[model samples]
Target: MCAKQDDAGAPHHHGPGTERDTDGSDRFEVDQEVQHALDRLTLLINAAEALSSTLEVDQGLRRLCRTLVPGLADWCAVDLLDDHGRLRRIVVEHRDADVTAPGLDEGLLPPTEGSAASVARALLGVGPVLLTDFPPPKDEDDPLCLREKQLFERLEADTAVVAPLRARRQVLGVLTLARTRREVRLTEDTLSLVEDLAHRVALAVDNARLHAEAQHTAERLQRSLLPELPTDGPLEVAARYQPASTTARVGGDWYDAFVLPDGAMALIIGDIAGHDLRAAVMMSQTRNMLRGIACDRKEPPGKILARLDAAHHILYPHQTLTCIYALVERLSADEPWLLHYAVAGHPAPLLVTHDGETRFLTGGRSLMLGVEPEVHRPAATDMLPPNSTVLLYTDGLVERREEDLDRGLARLRQHAAALAREPLTTFCDEILEGMAGGGSDDVALITVRTAPPHAGPAVATP
Candidate 1:
């Protein structure tokens, strides 16, 4: 009757101090101990991988929680301090989907000082705390305390480990774990493992915060430097820009449409070669230089770019870029509107007709800016068909990783043609909605919509 005489089909447990302890039969117990050690080692390895999986904080933490639940512990909860010095409950996870306590959604928590002593101590960077049986919160009036009480009642709380996530002499957050069964109390060994995990989590959180802050500052600076487009013009102009998604990868995509000293409207879109802050700085320098040269030189698109290339060669050497500089104008009322443009190692301009036909403006091509200053950058001209739109864009709009360059070009063309008949803003919006979804590269594009077929030699407004 002792332990029901365990058979091979059921798990066997040898009684302590029975014949197994002193005789040669103790080999089985030794084997069990070795196997348990191996399992713990495996869990630690997996936890490290999960924590370092991504630079995104919430995503990486969720991965870590999944690696722990139902295996390391029955429940895992992480609370992180924000830049505003507020404690935010980032995630709460349980092995079973049905096991949830009332008012247990993730959000900002009440000040840790008002909560249970264990949570308060952990947040203060006091060493790890082992939580066992405790009296129901003395004052359940506190939201944080009340929530913990509810969880204890609902999950039949047994044991828990609370550790401060500390890195660089500061506590960034706290990690909490709990198990329901009382027979297997979380021991000191478990406490050591939890502290190691908290250390890893702290470093990851710090890196993610730094990246986010940098990205925000860079984007704000970029927007501030961007020039406003002309709202009232015969050629209805609209532009769009989007930054790359990689962490801390910012800058280099820009678009501008404005009037030069003369009567012609200047259209410009370009991308500096790299995707870092240096790339962004060069982009601003290169863009401002081009605008100045265009205003003072009074030349065609080709010659204007020649000046840009020369100026940058002296001012910011060793930097390269792809660009399109075009002027859309008609000398007189009886003349047809014309587009004169030049491409400097840039993607060909796309032309979408009023009837859903698409074509690339492939003439006027030359090397990128940094390569050669003296080469004659060629120029091309095409008459604007009534209501047709010319789309100028950076490579990001028509290029992607591991895909043929032609394929991205074809995708852009297809999306542009389908939206050809829509309004100017909608056409640009839909094109972006269709082509720029989740692209990792930065993008800048300008849509120049001409007046309808003309009464004179030029296409005229109806």
Candidate 2:
């Protein structure tokens, strides 16, 4: 009976050992699965980081090809369709090898005359398309596909996958990958991954193209708005328009000088509110109105602005404008009086004396146009001596966020004083250069100097 009991206990001892072995095997399997998932997640994160860092489309394609091939496929090539719907090979990569030069030029495979590529072109309409089990045409043999098959034969590949890249439903390019049948068969999972990558590439390319187009348009508009400098003049004028640092925010800042009917020169500087197409449109309107008023009215600065204010409400009831308008009349042999200037919520004009002194012409202050119309009061007048220079500009010159307007004014004053003794043209250039260094807001400067009696006629200079 003791021997029987011992035998039963021996089997019970083995039961716990068996349970321990099972638990260890299960834990080992769970750990291996967890590690595989972690590795895949890490690889995806790294690839996404690489894709996001690039702005150049070609460099981005190369990076993408390097990231996908070997890990996802043995070979990969990106084919982009031109504007004419012709497929053009762009980027290509092979496992542990550089791209073959002739392969890129010869590897372009179109819609195979009437196969899946043609069907995709018709159905997708330039958007992303995925082709599975795509075969060459039944009738005439395709030279391109034959070449591709030969290439794949060398790589021992039996399956091919292609995905079109698209943005806003417009096809930008196509991505193709080939894999050996022994390593992996092309499946839905592989197709979905390629689609996602193509989408990202398309978005990046579209953004860059839009940015370039906008810049070109802005530059062309700026050139058209600014008139060429007068042919001959003693008064040299130079103007520069610097766009805002932030992309998509080009504003309206302009300067103008032309002879009035009365033989006096009219100098105008203004800034429109905000930075958009609306601001640019309003700028054009305001400038034309002021020019018309100055030429037709031939009145004092005060009366001209009153007319402008009335026109502003009639034309643009909801918009506003800030301006400094001055009329320079040659009074005597060597003296000029800047008659009847007003500031409608704009920066005061800067006056530089012949003795190298600078002062702000802070005269009458009134509400900006389009706000309310009242009897426009005449601003205070200051006489410009011979060789003296008067500078009129927009408030973007003296308005910084961290610093107060006073500080900006002080900085302008300091620079103006240093340039007071220089030629009016030089002074204007120096002021613009200094302001550009600080920060670029829209800037416009107009400089007019009183001519001496012996200096003869004052011609326009730009």
Candidate 3:
């Protein structure tokens, strides 16, 4: 063997019979190992991204499982310890769609003992467990082992790895990966990689659970802050609050219907400008303030909203919102109802007849509340015949990012007209079902129908 150096003092190692680095099997093996390492690093990066993609627990877990199946294993399963300390299988994802595992559906499994193997041991914080050439449990074996055996046989698993999903020095759950082919077996050497992936999974699951809990709490508080519709009244009323499609943010939409001291029925719908706990808290305060002012004064809807605007400006500066205020009243019980309403930077109130005719109340329009405290707002009145209905709603019901505002308005009109002749309860429900897909924002709507006892659209859903 011989080596020659060029003028640059570097060995060329070219030409026949000259010893070269490329011909050695050791060098080839080293190159293969480097490529394999690079590939594994890429896979791990993808898994992390998939896990953190969504704040939905099951969906995010499914993504992570998908990243593992057929890439690292034939299938994967995730078992989590619930709030009650019970072990529940939340995901069992298999690569082959044709393979059916009878007992592998996500559900509760029997208690895991401290001495159990693999998944159970991992749950007990025993670190990663690798199983090779495993055997199926007998019929009378430990319940947890029996379940695992059933899964193993169904998928024909020859090698498996179970690792604890750990975060903050605590084991939150367990991740299991099973390989059906013996040649592509998982060994103790790969336990480090599997355990590393499990840690990322644990963090994502923890974050998603926290987000869901916060969303539930905020929505519950918002619901509690809302006013209950009057059960005893001549007007049949129904109000609904639909949260946004994603619970990532708290909504500021609200609806209120209450009777004033002077016997006028007050109807209100409003939407504050933010999407956080602050907006929700402000909604409660604003609703209470408006209720008090409406009760204290005998003014029409416009005057009442003007007073509310002034108060909102003084208390919560730089905040803006849209609102509609209306008072339904008449001189006596026998007379027809008169709807005295005012609008402040809100959608027009809809009027639908018993015969399925619909129209938007474009009168009494003014800038939305919180804009001009001293601005003179106007009010409009419309006489409602027996069995007629009036609707007030937030922008969420008729607003889509990609479509024109007029198109959404038209969709609302079409749905409202078709549902007009239906019972009040039916009308409310069907309208929501029909129009909810129009936008992704939070929605709040109030419907008031005038009717005689046992005759008109005042039908209620108990």
Best by lDDT: 3
Q: Report the Cα lDDT for candidate 1.
A: 0.81
Q: Rank the candidates by lDDT, best first.
A: 3, 1, 2
Model 3 worst lDDT run, 10 consecutive residues: 453-462
Query: Highest TM-score, which number?
Result: 3
The lDDT values for all models are: 0.81, 0.69, 0.84
> How would you encode candidate 1's per-residue C-alpha lDDT over 341-411 as one tens digit per residue?
99999899999999989999998889988888988998999988878899998887777787999999999
Of 2 and 3, the candidate ranking higher by lDDT: 3
lDDT of 3 by residue, 81-108 (tens): 8888778888888998678442447888
The alpha-carbon RMSD values of the candidates against the true structure, listed in the order shown, are 7.5, 8.9, 4.4
Q: Could you tell me how far off, in angstroms, the CA of residue 78 lies in candidate 1 after the best superposition?
A: 1.1
TM-score of decoy 2:
0.63
Q: How far is candidate 2 from the true structure (C-alpha RMSD, Å)?
A: 8.9
Which residue pairs collide in model 3, if any?
A: 344-368, 345-368
Candidate 1 structure, TM-score to reference: 0.85
Cα error, residue 163 of model 1, in Å, equals 1.8
